[model samples]
Target: MKEKDGISECPEQQVILYVEKEDGKYEAMQTGSYISANYLDDYFLKRGTLEKALGEKIARGEINAIEYYMILEDLTISELAARAGIMKWTVRRHLKPGNFSNISESALKKYSIVFNITVKEIVTRQSGNRN
Candidate 1:
């Protein structure tokens, strides 16, 4: 089946599945192309007890994608700074939207420590306009 955006979902028996996003929303093209509730239950059971997780982090009265990336991975500015070998302010500047640029190694390291995630997961080249 095709979704409004013409995206199709190809369901598989794998426990972990990938969902496509269109215009910032999830779209399913056809039934059975997506996993059913029962499938999720069985997948979660096979893995372990699931914990509540947020899609992103809220900060400064705004939902910044960088903030969400850091929070979801459990990273902090100070820690990331140390890892990048740069000042915290530098890290902040890079994290801000529209400031698409490379981050220092020290910052990447700190992010890894705080979020318990990998450097590859934290850093992303901005897409489209900087802001």
Candidate 2:
């Protein structure tokens, strides 16, 4: 993933601060500054965790690759279908664990292309439980 230089702020950003006067009284002051969040690492960490969990689930046969892509990969059924060049119903059907083993090699290839992984890797690589 490409690194971003923090968040971009809109032109009308504003902030308020309290100022202490000579009499020890507080006064309100308005200032304009850009606020940015440096959470890219945290975001990637959480996404990695989710990917691991999804891989484990797929390995355990608790969920199929379709479900893993839909949940962990954050893709909608229609989007996945379009990427795979298949119908949404076909994608939904493949989401069933029982139907996963019946997926055609061509369809598997399409899914591998969409996920940017090899067919063998997608089928065999299992991120087993850590413990």
Q: Which regions in candidate 1 have their CA more than 4 angstroms from the true location? A: 1-65, 73-86, 124-131
For all predicted structures, in order, the TM-scores are: 0.34, 0.61
lDDT for model 2, please: 0.69
Reference-based lDDT, each prediction: 0.48, 0.69
- RMSD of candidates 1 onward, in order: 15.8, 10.2
The lowest-lDDT stretch of 10 consecutive residues in candidate 1 is: 50-59
lDDT of 1 at 80: 61
Model 1, range 1-108, lDDT digits (tens) per residue?
Answer: 113433324454323323455556555433332354236667676444321122212222233344555554456877666655667887788766545336556655
Best by the TM-score measure: 2
